[model samples]
Target: MDSQTMRDLVMYWQGVTLDDEAASRLAALSTSVGKTLNAVAGGSMFDTEPAHYDRALIAMAERSDD
Candidate 1:
């Protein structure tokens, strides 16, 4: 996700007003997490398969709903 989206998500989950500095820090952390996720996904062969990934996501969502 982009920085704006990440910032919005952080703000929503944090449920507190953030100053510019705090927002910047959260955005940086989001970027780092995104990079790490990309790296891990790149290293995984299973993630390359779209259908399986979609199915896994669906399964997880179903479990959460249950």
Candidate 2:
């Protein structure tokens, strides 16, 4: 995620603010996590579906029921 998005998440989701140094570290950590997940998911792209796909399906079902 972009640094601004990361900062927004920290403030919006976590309800906290970090200093410049901590924000930069948080950005680096997010980058590292994204890279690792990409590498791991690359091989399994065809073999597996995203975990969120289930949530989407559930939401669709709920909408239909409504």
Which candidate's TM-score is highest? 2
RMSD in Å for model 1: 9.3
Query: Model 2, 1-66: lDDT tens per residue?
Result: 667777788999899987777778889998899899998777657766657987878777855546
What TM-score fits each model? 0.44, 0.54
Task: Give the per-residue lDDT of model 1 (tens digit) for 1-66.
Answer: 445665677779886766667777778887899899998777657645456777788677745545
lDDT of each: 0.72, 0.80
lDDT of 1: 0.72
lDDT of 1 at 27: 83
Single out the weakest 10-residue window by summed lDDT for candidate 2. Answer: 57-66
